[model samples]
Target: MSILLYFTIVPLGTAFLVTLLRKKKGISDLLAVLSSLYLFGLSLATAGLTKSHGVMIYKVGGWFPTIGITLVVDGLSAFLLVAINLVAFLVLIYAISYMERYTDKWKFHALFMFMLAGLNGVIISGDLFNLYVFLEIASISAYALVAFGVKPQNLEAAFKYTIMGAVASIFILLGIALLYSYTSTLNMADVAYCLSDKAKNPLLVFIWVLFLAGFGLKAALVPFHAWLPDAHSSAPSPVSAMLSGVVIKTIGIYALMRIFFNVLGVSINLLSVLMASGILSMVVGAFLAIAQNDIKRMLAYSSISQVGYIIFALGVGTPLAILGGLFHLFNHAVFKSLLFLDAGAIEYSTGERNMDKLGGLNNKLPVTGYTSLMAAMSISGIPPLAGFWSKLIIIVAAVEAGYIGYAIVAVLISIVTLVYYLKFQSFVFFGKLDAVYNKIQEVPLAMKTALVILAVICVMGGLMLTGTFRPFLEGASNVILSGTGYKQAVLGAIR
Candidate 1:
């Protein structure tokens, strides 16, 4: 549908327009907020269309899929588009107030919208080269945003991030090139169709390794996660929310899912590797988070651990496992963003991020504190909340898949997760009111509005598994479960 074009066009157009309006105060904010809101609504509409129409393919310039750019939306892409745009809209709202602490808010808006365009493009892109291009656009924007503060530390973090990101891009590009070389086509469906006829070979195995290394680094899976803590902690909080919440998922986990499960197809060896990586990330991230005093840094590490849950669940490759993985992906986007925004609110109020230096903020920033608590509880997998249900699904799926040992590890890591979050809650919100912060106030209204909306999602997110909402997650999981049928679906749609 033509509407698919708006996903990238609106954000790209807004980025350019906002840059042109540098002289108009508040105009950039107005445009950015309105564009994001529009995109969020558009994404929801697209999700509805995906539900009604199944897979929809839009060939650019009305050309055939083999020679033209194609933007496709199936249940999976529609689900991710909704998650990505919803989070982007909320993050933009929070940024309006929080970004006032920095100069040239217009520039921030421009880069943010630019990043959003890349993210949306990556989701809808139906070819490999365009996927890499959009991935780099988002990566470059993130690199600049990380250094927006212009601090020595911020620049250092951005530099490290850029280097690591470049390395990842190279690996991904090489994988794409190899795949194209083998298949003589860059269209995802065509590539899969070609691969289906070829016998499994060592070259395909090498390509899979290249992709796993590349996307694994992007996802911040353990051992490839060196850049994440610095990048997330150094960037603005709303940016951190985007990075931890959806950016990593769209460019990293989502790409892995599409390519591994849908394109190249999964293997026993691939599943084993994914499970190992996910377990390592879970253990390492939780341990590292426990040692952090910086709130953002701790939350950054927490993102790695939570991402592990999704990756591990997906690795199990059961229907229930895929459902849990996708659900947790959505839940993480909500609660993790909420947590980071709360951290931003704390910083806005007291200019402190060290938990040791912040205490009893609940009295001063009640919305932030309680919301943080709710997010904390939910992310810790407490009962009846979003995080709990997803985690429970994962654990049950693991047991059913006969990975009892891995299931036990997941439970232990969850307890570790609870410990660190409680530590966070106790250190930042539950202690006696500090004398230094007595006069500090809550964050501005826009920031508070974002936090509350996310908190409500965390509270209600469990309903996604029931009644009307069940189809959203189920639809996405069905896409992954379809295997090579995805190629047939896309090719058939084109004909």
Candidate 2:
């Protein structure tokens, strides 16, 4: 239980400090930064421990067998916790300076930390009901974060996001109620164990549909993705980076993967559904992004497309495909965040985001321009970059799995991904300097630092699949591949 307490306490503590010392902005910033940094350290330490000791389980209230909640930190959960905290720490530091343009920076920081706590909680919770509660904690905070700018579009986006989120939550809760009624257990392992006794429950089929729709909304999968562009683009950039970078993965794909593959048991039919959704996202996201003039809007749509690739790979159900999907998830987190932060830096410097009005940024803001270019090329799947390696893995997985049609679609979508990134690069930073932007200054130092960190990661993320990090990624993927067999690992730990 120390694991859960440690992760949640740091953020909740920082929030208290923010509330108590509202007037001391500098002090609050320092406290918030330190809190996030400490949390990141905790996540890293957790990673190392999990590497050495394997899955760590903390039975809440010392209750055994199904009475209280359980927080299980396995390879997969540990990996995501580390990823979420890692980016959140950088984004928090970026927010310290980037948020200066707006008022009430401390409020932003507090809410941000709370949001992180909720995300970590969602990733670690081993019970369905507890997972829902943490999902709410993160979703509610996200709703407020979306409206932080207080612009009409911001408010509108937040309202839409909230309403959709509510609908999704209701669906999820209803499904949980159904499952609880059927199995009388909220703990995932208990439910799975009980489920294995029943050959296949019809109620489970219904619950599966509910979960797909509910988590689909969170993931911004194609049909359920209406509010993402407005909300992500309008929110402050750090929030945008976090939203696209890791939030969707945690709340949507990661949750879906866990419940389906580990808890409910994966089936060929479900894999088909996953692949179809993935393909739709890839094609549609790429096509729509090519038409947007707003810099952030375009990038938001692109995320929808790229995420499809990961979903599709996982759906393919081959070991190679799952590896590719997981790898892409990690790489996308880095480059996509960097891209959004780069957009933020542009807005900070020039106060403009329209591609039509942006030009010649390389001359005026060399760091932002160069860093963004690295991100663009990396995201576009240029050779030697992380994106290229992951994409190669996915395509190879598709071809080797004999999903030749999907492989063709994957290659085509990648080409499309490149087209848009090149368009973004040429239009925003490489052409004649927009005459109107002559007086613009470079991005604030803190923002530049975050961008640089992400850019370097974008370049090096591929290395993760090759060295010591290779085991980390493979181990986490193996947990998912464990499928219903996951019970063996958890049950063994409990014994």
Q: Which candidate number maximizes lDDT? A: 1
TM-score per candidate? 0.99, 0.99
Model 1, residue 287: distance off in Å is: 0.6
Model 2 CA deviation exceeding 4 Å by range: none
Q: Write the per-residue lDDT of candidate 1 for residues 1-495, one digit (tens) a residue.
A: 899999999999999999999899999999999999999999999999999999999998898897988998999999999999999999999998999999999999999999999999999999999999999999999999999999998999999999999999999999999999999999999999999999878999899999999999999999899999999999999999999999999999999999999999998889988998999999999999999999999999999999999999988999999999999999999999999999989999899899998888788888999999999999999998999999999999999999999999999999999999999999999989889888998888999899999999999999999999899889899999999889999999888
lDDT of 2 by residue, 134-171 (tens): 89988999999999999999999999999998999899
* Model 1 local distance difference test score: 0.94
Lowest-lDDT window of 10 residues in candidate 2? 1-10
